[model samples]
Target: MKVHLLIQRTFAGLNTEYTSNPAIAQLDNKLFLTDERSVVMQITENPVFSFAKNEKWTCYSFIKRALDREKRAGFYAVRLFISSAHKLTNVKDCLLTIAQRYEFFIQNNTPSQEYTDLLTQINEKAIIEKERYTFDIESIRKGTYYAIATAENLEALFADERNEFVEKLYLFTTNIDSKLLAEFHLHSIDPLSVVKWQINDEKKALDKLWLENTAIPVFAKKLLSLQGAKLYFQLKGQQEKRELTGTNELKTTALIIDDADKCITSLKINNTAVKPQPYFELYALATDTLYYTLKNGKEIPLPITAKLSTRKLIVENSENALAKLWVNGEELPIPTGKKFEIYALTTDKIEYTIVGQAGKKTTVNSDIKTLSIHLPNRGQTINDNKKSPVIDILLYALLSLLVGGIIGYFYRSNTSEEDISAIEQKIQEKEAKYEQVKKELNSSQILPNNTATKTVTSTTTNTIKSNNTTTKTTNVATKTTNTNSKTTK
Candidate 1:
């Protein structure tokens, strides 16, 4: 984090011209104040509040009130300093009595909860006095920098403050440009109550602050850049244990250990955690099987009753290409020029190998220990496994036919010729009945009365023609007889 300090000037009755300091810059997690006298003060990872000259008094007063409020809330004010003209001096002790007397003024003020305990410790070990240290023109000119230090407990400063108490003092001599003065400064002076110790312990103190105050969730996503094997914290007893695995994304899994010491778990892809479930679930996209090994045995078998609900393998092609699918180590033959959807429900890992006629190829393998639902080429998705009712019915019918065929095969092997003939006759009878029903069904469109009428009309026309032909024959016979009679007469 980088912070910029801007200094400006303002006078009571004159136009205030200000010069900005560009040479001095704060970087990283540290603050530095330097002067022409070669005196420098450094604070590591300190939170500094800056203000314009016009706002200096208000800001200083706000900080004072904030400190006093924290003191009353139970935090101990440790060391206060006003730094300027090549020196740092303690001024907190001078205001301690005033703080104690006016401590009630900050009774309702809001200070961070962390400072409360320190202030209480400070007030407990202090005496109240009526005189208050006041900041005036002379004091402001002498002190160009101010700082406050606080601690939750007093014992922290016993070692360092005892030896360096005198060295912390500062002196002012010559008049310097107002621009050189810090825009705002205040310090809480009490060795036992400074909060510096907590800040010094960066890992313990700042880590919590970072987790709570910073965008750590976003940073956690960026942590995926540190790919390959990584360790994550998991609860084991009252302590956290590092669980290591190879991953390309941030995923959580439930750690399960079998009696044979084999580990089984699940993983999430793209950092998408399983929702509405207490434990994380991983899905294989291209496979429809679960992988598991028998305890103390190397052989893995697909249970006969194992079924998958959310697994499918799909292939799509527009040309003559064979797509090969492999479950575990078995490769499936896929014909070209057709799309296919295959579902395999087994208790083992399924590996899908896809090859194209045009040299395009891909392989996807999923561990059965983790539930994964994936698709290849965004082509097709396999959802939860559901048994179709029609398929179930067909399976039952086929099983019945197979059983009957087996029984009939054995029965016929021992049967006599008469019995065989009788069976053949019965089959023929059934075939005839079936044929009759089929014919009736095929001629269902023709009415019975219409068929009968057509038949009767054809019969009547044939009979009439026959009768005319007979009459003609008889007439010819008579004509021949008359001709013979006339000739004779």
Candidate 2:
């Protein structure tokens, strides 16, 4: 379904300057304008039509029209352009190859009637878009791919090389009715519509298909084919519908999503309401995974099962929008009572902030998950209770010491001269009193006092030589006078 070509074309010279039409003078001048600002030679078609046909030119419109003509061979021819990655190089031989592939596909497109029936009855929820409906037969480790497309896309499907079509047998297996098929065939649709296609090992699903009650020959043949001829007798032995235990009564069991991250509120199995159960008995079948919503307003997927076979089960959320309330770790049901619940925060300090949202009032805690705060309500953080009272006493003592130091510093720095003089006088008087006490203590001391002591002394001198001299002179004068009186008187 692929086209590979080695195309070769020969180029020839022209006679005219640019265009075939003379009226388009501007275009001719523009096309022929050169880097030197002068009009270059324009290309003219060969005089003979055959000469022109053989010649190749640098003209886009001409090439496009010729290619368009080539593509009109069929939708397959045009489809080559839709999937233009291949250039879809459809020469004479490439066109024949595409036709052959189309023939093979039409011949092999048939599927079993059961498959067609299954498509006709498939649920809309199960039908996938994007050209193909994928059926996962997980047990058989196989998948079936079906598509609805135009004849062009169908041919392109082959060229697409959808994986290697090995011995596994690449074919379309459909389960839609003839009416839809007719519609698909009659019109080349933009949005193609097709039915479901079941994959290989599809026989396992027949257990839920009501095969036991069907008496049709085709159903019987299908059963034989699925069981295999070697085990036909063994399968026949187990075919009889025997009620082993009619005494086992049906019980209601809650469903849960086995392993899911998302919370589901409205869940439906075939379409009745169901809840989640932590544990279930042996008589349960897990058919669907559903979601459960908590009071914290979180949705999670939980696996679901019924104690008895349910024809239809559905779960829908019926709670109000203001139902997001949780205490401890558990989520509570929606609160519509007269009184609201209280919360005890473990933090020492809490702040309340307000934000304006359009015209509505928004608080800081409005978006808080663990704790909820109502407007006009104050919050406080929890303080540590383990600190000793001795710390307070130590702090008070340090404060007193600091105050005393500050007062002493100010007394020294801001003292007046009068105050300094009075202090100096008082210091002098105290020093005199200390000296007097020191002398008294020296006189009364038992140990020898080595202090220095001072003592006072006086001396007198007399002159008696003058009186003796005067007496001697008077005696001599008297003796002389007596001698002279004896001589002269």
lDDT of each: 0.30, 0.27
- Cα lDDT tens digits, model 1, 243-296, are 323432323222221221222223122232222222222232111123433322
TM-score of every prediction relative to native:
0.19, 0.19
> Worst lDDT window (10 residues) for model 1?
54-63
Worst 10 residues of 2 by lDDT: 454-463
Tell me how candidate 1 scores on lDDT. Answer: 0.30
Per candidate, the number of residue pairs that clash is 46, 27
RMSD of each: 23.1, 33.2
Q: Flag regions of model 2 displaced more than 4 Å.
A: 1-291, 295-379, 382-397, 408-489
- For candidate 2, the per-residue lDDT at 318 reads 24
Instruction: Report the C-alpha lDDT of model 2 over 1-489, residue by residue, as the tens digit.
Output: 221111111112111212213332222322221111111001111110000000111111111011112332111110111111222211223334433443354358533211222222221222222232221122111222223324344345332322111101111222234464353332212232222222222122122222223222212222211111111111111233221122211121343233121222343333323453333222112343444343234544445433221111111112211324333344445446433332312211223222221233222232232233222112111112123445534543453454344434433553444543444444345445545644664454411232311100000001112323444676688889899888885
